[model samples]
Target: MTDQRQDAIPDAIPGAVPHTRGVRFAVYSAHAKAIDLCLFDGENETRLPLNRTATDLFALHVAGLKPGARYGFRAQGVYDPDRGLWFDPSKLLVDPYARELDRPFRHDARLSTFGVDTASLVPKAIVTEDRPVAPAAPRLPKGGLIYEVAVRPFTLLHPKVPAALRGTVAALAHPAVIAHLKRIGVDAVELLPITAWIDERHLPPLGLSNGWGYNPVAMMALDPRLVPGGMAELAATVATLHENGIGVILDLVFNHSGESDRHGATLSMRGLDNLTYYRHVPGAPGLLVNDTGTGNTLACDHPVVRRLILDTLRHFVRQAGIDGFRFDLGTILGRSPQGFSRESETLRAILSDPLLADRVMIAEPWDIGPGGYQLGQFPPPFLEWNDRARDDIRLYWRGDGWKTGRLAHALAGSSEIFSAHGLGETRSVNFLAAHDGFTLMDLVSYSHKHNEANGEDNRDGHNDNHSWNNGVEGETRDPAIRDSRRRDVQALLGTLFATRGTLMLTAGDEGGRSQQGNNNAYAQDNALTWLDWTTLDDDLVTHTARLARLRRRFDVFSESAFFTGQDGDVLWLNEQGKPMTTADWEQPDRQQLTMLLKTRDREEDRATRLAVVFNRSHDALAVHLPGGPWQDLFTKDHVFSPVLPPRTVIWLRELADPSARDKEAGES
Candidate 1:
């Protein structure tokens, strides 16, 4: 062993730092009276008391320690839950900056604060060698087209993915997966959380695992089950995606951990210093501020937690080559003692940080806490998930009255809601379905949520899905019903592609994958939640691909600016081909409408115009055209007297210039 005589560096950063000697283990605990570093080897263990600094940071340089050494921290302090000072030395604590964990966490009574001995039950932090990572490529501001997916379910049923790689992060880099993503025109893969997590206490008894991976236990450590080969596997996946011009954006859950409410386990953060890591209810000591709906909300306002979050992000960016991050329950990051603020310390630090400044930042923008519905409240450079647009789109297609006006605003990027906040159309991440809600297929197939398999008596998932079952509920054998469902699915996808905002597509939506109407499949990690690759609807995939191609081809679809009546860029017309007035918008019962989108800065003297018609009424309507020779882009049918089928969306482009065809093909 090398000499351990070097001078101590005061106020050094936390976690294990590599040096010529071996490694320097350090941790921060503001209220810990004593801290011990325990190194494990087989059943044997060696404990060393770390030298405490004036700044309350504990440090120890062990000369013989090497990479892959299993280690954990034992913080000794007051175990007074009533006072919110949970520091149980018997329970081993994971390093907040641990790059890798040895095993998946198994929750037991011994892993709680009440247990006297629980070292063997907890996972140990494994020291890893730092590897150079490739620089991340620039991600599109609006993410172009974000595809949200869970890593495991997305590949488990894939016939092309190798058996060993299935349900692992490596599957994301498989050629078949990459090809499928490209086929769907996905610019970024917003992967569901891959961080180490533990199932909620209630899930194990029901024999179900959390499928969507939102319950993160360690923000920095990749789940051993998901990435069996460790960070290198994730890095390889990111590199593969980047090579194909696709960015990887992780959906991170920093708002809460797998450690549930006060009665939850004594995990890493809680064991180390619960008083500092979690936000407590203002006068009630043991009561945690449960803004995340996951029992305890992380105190992002605290300096220590703030640093941990930023460091975790930088680690992913620099070590795994992550292009961006989509914050789950993003409102928590901007919440303060008073309420949610755009200038919150954590939010500001993330925006101003050099390492993350250029990366794409998407926000879920809401939580179950007070003042948590901050949809248009996040500051600039942050794209927010537009739930308003989602709800309005569902309502409009469901044939709800007074929805046409709301649908119009949503398709136009909900400018009325976001514009005043200085957010452009691109800042709205619009989607008809997401991981938390119904799949696209379920959106039109089922009228109610079927979450009985989740073991909560079907009371777990969202009750108000705003979905329509067409003329029949659930799956049907009737050809007419199937055709209607198919048509509605196509219409919804086409509308999403045409809308002016950052479009997000759930993984299996393009292939018509259904979850049997289980909106909240968070705890059903079975075939019910997995994609049925063999039964993927090819026709639906083709239609979705066509829409994606159109979105890429037309500049009008992804324009940043909001439509102004004076710009001549867009014209709102009623089914009669006349310019619409306020009365047209106020007609709650009217469902037939048309949007004349004039191509931006075309080479022709008169710009090429495309009229998108939406006929949501039950009967077919003869849509009057705006006095121009038009061709149906889908059927190539000439629009002499355009008669649209009920519940149909048709796109008609002007054939004034013959060269327009060549331009369109070249653009696609």
Candidate 2:
């Protein structure tokens, strides 16, 4: 504990003295005639009575308050529940917008945010002042590929990552990890929830924790367990990633928390002001609303909760240079009192906020409530995780046809689903695999999900995985069958890069990472999920790099917005460059889909094109070129394969030098 002047809003950034020195501090406490900014100075309370004009703004401008000073507010007001005004002068309340906190509020009886002795069955407040300043981590977004990762097991046993840095945010900035990401061409790293959270009681006893990070307790603070030197080390990591042109994004969980159902204890929100933060049943005074498959859902419709969400977001952006945020179960953010509204205030605030306006705000897009599947309905400037694209691509490649039309729309950025909302191709965050379901290898090797490792008796995880086993269930002794499976996995990776949208590949998908058959590896935190860096499979590594390199070379394949018109930027054609017929799209066993992605070639000042032929059937198919001299980028040859074998994806790029390949062929 140290003594500090208590006059202004403290700064959270290092080196720079608080610009808010001598600035006023205020919070809306309408009932409190007198409010005190209880500054925790040197183990003593340096209390300052706030000078107020109106009841709405409880404010004060006194001296000696600097950065790192732990403080809370005490207000005097009527203790009531039905009318929604509960203020206890003896209780200490944290500022809803505080940039930093000493320690997270312990879920003890003493620190209830709600009033303990209400006239009725009202809530109570947890009166505890913060201590020590917790530094804030820098935020990230921009010019990066965000790889969402679970924090705890990311580097728990990596030989390169220091034992001290393991399992923490600072660990991500370790030299070895950073080098790996750079080597793989990853631009951004998105961490799953780092906010303080409580484990689900049911999971805690079984050695399973909330690995997905769907539960959150502290919104503005970093999880101490994942921070070595605490927020300061986390903050340093941000600066480091930014120096390397990489960005960071958090998997925010504002939908629900560990506190669930009507029987949960009164913690932060339930103890402070239950009605203000959580959605409740209409007539039941104590029955809380649940929608996130969790016990309760934070009501984004409420004024306080809305303000809390906005303040927390703005605080992170200001204190840290974070480039973006990825919202888990984000559909709940669009819900209103009437129902889930696309034009809800929560959504409106995110768009209008100057600090977050240009940030990479991505939504999980679906929940467990009614009309919860708000896939393509998110407003503009938002990226949605396109589960439809994931499933369709998997199904098509497995030879489940009569689906070519829908696959085309997805490959072209799902204009059918998002164009009406004024969004383009980049709005869809396309991926063939994510952490929630099966890995790319598992999707091709196992038709059924093997989630017994999750300890839920295989009852958990999605049943309709849109997968194929390639003639065998587990391992196969047949060489031909094994080769086919490996090729299909490569085809899926190629399609992910060739698709017109923001591509999100799971960490190990590029190298054919597998979990044996476990679709849900959330709890497996072992060799099953950790990337195997030891395997030196040169061909597989080269193939994955080739896919990423192709995406980097051709803008049309990775363009933010898909081009319209037959000759614009992309084209869907049959074998002979003609319109695809219903029979062609519906042919179940016919397994070739040809798509041409065109881009503006700067050197020649003309549009360059790349034709990708995806052959998925067991038999070979002859694909005709779209009436042009195409160069095979790999071999620098003009010889196009008229007949390509099954489970293969061939890419041919139009070259600027007409004689580039001819000269090479002559030399050969």
Q: Per-residue alpha-carbon lDDT of model 2 for 429-499, expressed as tens digits?
A: 88888878888888888999998877889988889999989889866769987787789887887777677
Runs off by more than 4 Å, candidate 2: 1-144, 422-426, 474-482, 524-528, 535-538, 601-606, 634-638, 656-668
| Model 1, runs deviating above 4 Å | 1-7, 141-143, 422-426, 600-607, 638-641, 658-668
Residue 174 lDDT in model 1?
93
lDDT at 377, model 2: 89
Maximum-TM-score candidate: 1
TM-score list, all predictions = 0.95, 0.81
lDDT values for all models: 0.84, 0.67
lDDT of 1 by residue, 251-363 (tens): 99999988889788887888888888899989987999899878999999999999999999998998888988999999999998899998899999999999889888999
